[model samples]
Target: MLVGAASMIDSVRTWLRPDPIAERQVDPVGFAGTATVAATDYFAWDQEDKPSRTTALDRIAEPGADIDGWNGAGKQRVDGVAVLDVNRFARELAVVTVQVHVIPFTKPAAPSQPGGLKASWTALPARWLTAAIPVRSLPGGRFALSGRPALVGQGHSADLGNDAATEPPDADFSADTTVVVSKLLTAYGTGDLEFVRAAGAGFLGLDGAAELAELDEWRVAPKADNSGVRIGTATVRWRLPGDATLACTYRIAISDRDGIWLLSAITVDAGGPR
Candidate 1:
């Protein structure tokens, strides 16, 4: 019978797959604080604590979640939550998202006819929304709320900047690769790893964690497949701690050795593409 129907379709596809390291042994930061306290008690409420906010959304949703279709007219609060993204989907599902902030819950505008005289305003402009939730996981690593928390919408814009690999003829570095990127950003702003191992850098310097304050622009390219590397791109300026500054741009690599140049590697270009 055609080799017993291909060995019972390979034992029903190994009992319907799943366990390819069950979603890489999950750990979306252990359910981002149970999806930020179940989307902050699923977008709070307060019509005089509607029965303890319906007993905190029936102790974190999912037992027939409709989230008690709020009949208790307006009023929310939150004022801060966070999380912002998790997704997952296996080793016990996941979703997360978050953001929040809210505020609403106004009261104080009436006064059009009677003893006209009120307009003091009490609240209702704050905003930031976003939500999502879903969660699940449990069994020690903990997390729950498996449903109700929709809202969402805020994330649209993608170009992945390649603007012709940062335009222009640019790509000529040999003035000792601009003095080894200005003494590796002045020994990465003074935490000087022995002047970056006497400028041959094997890595490790931003030890002072930033204070350079200026070296504001640079560029080089030539690594089409390494002719002894080259790739730079600088553009710095740190300062901070009140004396404010912060510019940043890094993307180095340099290397040349023997004919010296060194500095090896760096990162933080943080734009799209290359």
Candidate 2:
């Protein structure tokens, strides 16, 4: 009777347990269009008149697949698709999670106590590959790998960076540059010289308000260096009202001045301030 009861309890527990694999998604467009590698060849994927993200991913999974059909496909705007590579993608996330080095239940910055940043990779591959996807909608967004991560501290030849050097530092720095440039441009457009001078003290090179006011429009063209220190470009339509747009490249340098990442300097590259 004891053995039978135990058997019954085990059967009920098995039925009550949830499946291991889980559903996840990422925006492929976000991956390819900015700060990340192309989930798949965008040009080739857009071949379908009305391209489907899943179809594109399926084709990408094929080896040396002829993707010519996707060529010359018109502009594509993809969003809100799920990524289904459970084993690999989740493994990446797990790596990211372990990399945090903070105790899961404690404050992130608190020092490690005893056993810290524990991880087990034993079941990850099976979890990713064997996972079931009940809903088949909008898949293949995972391939949109984020920009080359500064994946330091992972047994690599460099203890130079901090442990909390999470995956998105490069992405964060790049985004910050865009914001600064935009702020400066807005001040220039609105003839707010006082604001410009104050904000651009460490950055912009302007002769005077009158010269800045000449900029009819300013825009941060998406072209930028993908490296850790992003050097970005902005198009300044000089002599505003009607002037050629000058491609201006600004070097964004981050410094640990006073132990904080103040935007140390935003100097123009050689022949940069046109």
Candidate 3:
């Protein structure tokens, strides 16, 4: 009788225990893509195609959400949309910030008298706008807008502060590093892989994608944080077929084996000359 009572008690406990809720997984890239598409559709309209716009909103957003209340007076066009930031609040919810390049235009106002003004569109300048969109995840890899997007101000640029030093070339190995950089760039200009392999050793170059017109400026700095690795920055001008020139800045890594300098890697640094 005691064994029976104990078994009943255990069964009751098991049946009464609550099941744990599994957290939903969020895909940042996929969510960004969805947000971009939704933003594009939200801004695109011809006024005549009202049905299409309504259908698009219905597919992406919930019912009765007034995403865009354009009184059919103005037309908005989207030039581009990019994901600026993604902040996930919970496993199933997030707020994605996006930059939208849009062109807004409206029809001219009717004149007080007939034939006073022509029926032409007064187009405003193209500009960028920031938006914060609340999104929620659903079952089977689907997403929905929890609310309408709110237009916000521009995003702030990063400030590294004034005390940051632009690492200058090391005096001792500057000349030697310059020689290695010149050789690699010369070979890279003509798409000469064999010469680059011999000069840079393990470095793979641009495969002659650009014609190097001039090596404008270069600076070498031994990495203060890492020994045997020196950082180099160079501004190179490229010659286009129609006599056009494009100047680009590149950052390169050089390995110092005793005194021999070898190119380790090279890449374009952001905010460098366009």
Candidate 4:
């Protein structure tokens, strides 16, 4: 009877135990577009052939600025400039309201987590607006792909030594380069596991030579009741310093008879100079 009771108790414990979900690190990929301004001759006034007459016809050249499109299309013209006078030739002007979009992939929750997922958008300001040319010019140049925002929080992880036995230093989590995170998210959606791994390893400064462990513990809490597990759907806002990258790790956990098992770890790369 004692043996039977023990068996029953084990069964009950097993039933209450939660299973360990798969664990893997996710890395983000990056994509960027620069706003450009070009000089286009919309309408040119022909020079009047008649010479001596004291009064020449009032000719005008309407020069327009074209900003490259953001989502795959023709360049867009700068607004508020029409009918430029001949006297104003080679004059300078400023364009305002240039916009760009940075999108990231949707993250998935570990199987062990509970509650529905949630996701939202977060924005980090650019360290400095990288205008192709000084804002003084009418047709401004394109913003270059250089200049990253400062990193916030801790910096990147340190490298491990040649021997596999030694552990690597912890990653610098304070660096806040926005570009890193944006790039990471892009890679995640495309299923570029290599890129994801590289980003994670670089940001964390883990043993590059060593293999990364899969996600171990998964847990989820609902924003409200009745909501299912929804980790990927939720969004978290973060900031970084000038041209620096930010890295953060989150864990997932599950309950078991013995205790709790780790399921996965998520690393985020964020903030960089433009």
Question: Which candidate number would show the highest lDDT if scored against the true structure?
Answer: 3
Give the true-structure RMSD of model 1. 17.6
Which has the better TM-score: candidate 1, or candidate 2? 1
> Residue 146, candidate 2: how far off, in angstroms?
11
Best-matching candidate per TM-score? 3
Clashes of 4: 79
lDDT of 1 by residue, 204-240 (tens): 4544533665665676754466567556556666552
Give every collision pair in model 3: 169-220
Stretches of candidate 2 above 4 Å error?
16-38, 41-274
- Displacement of residue 17 (Cα, Å) in model 4 is 56
Kindly list the per-residue Cα lDDT of model 3 for residues 1-274, writing each as its tens digit: 9999999998897668733343345577766877898888875665545787778878887444445433343466789999988766566666677878877665456533475644555667777656556566767678877555644323311111111125545656666556667776776666464633334345334444346667767776654676676666666665532233445555556666666655555543222111
TM-score of 1: 0.27
**What TM-score quantifies how close candidate 4 is to the native fold?**
0.15
In candidate 4 the C-alpha lDDT for residue 184 amounts to 38
Worst 10 residues of 3 by lDDT: 156-165
Give residue 23's error in model 1 in angstroms: 12
Worst 10 residues of 4 by lDDT: 38-47
Model 3 bad stretches (over 4 Å) = 1-23, 63-68, 108-122, 155-274
Compared with the true structure, what per-residue lDDT tens digits does model 4 show for residues 1-274? 9999999999897668733221211111111111122111110011121231111111111123121111121111222222111111112321111221212222222322346543332233322111111112212232221111111112222211111112231123112222333343333323343534332232221221112222222223322233221121112222212111222222111112222221112322111210
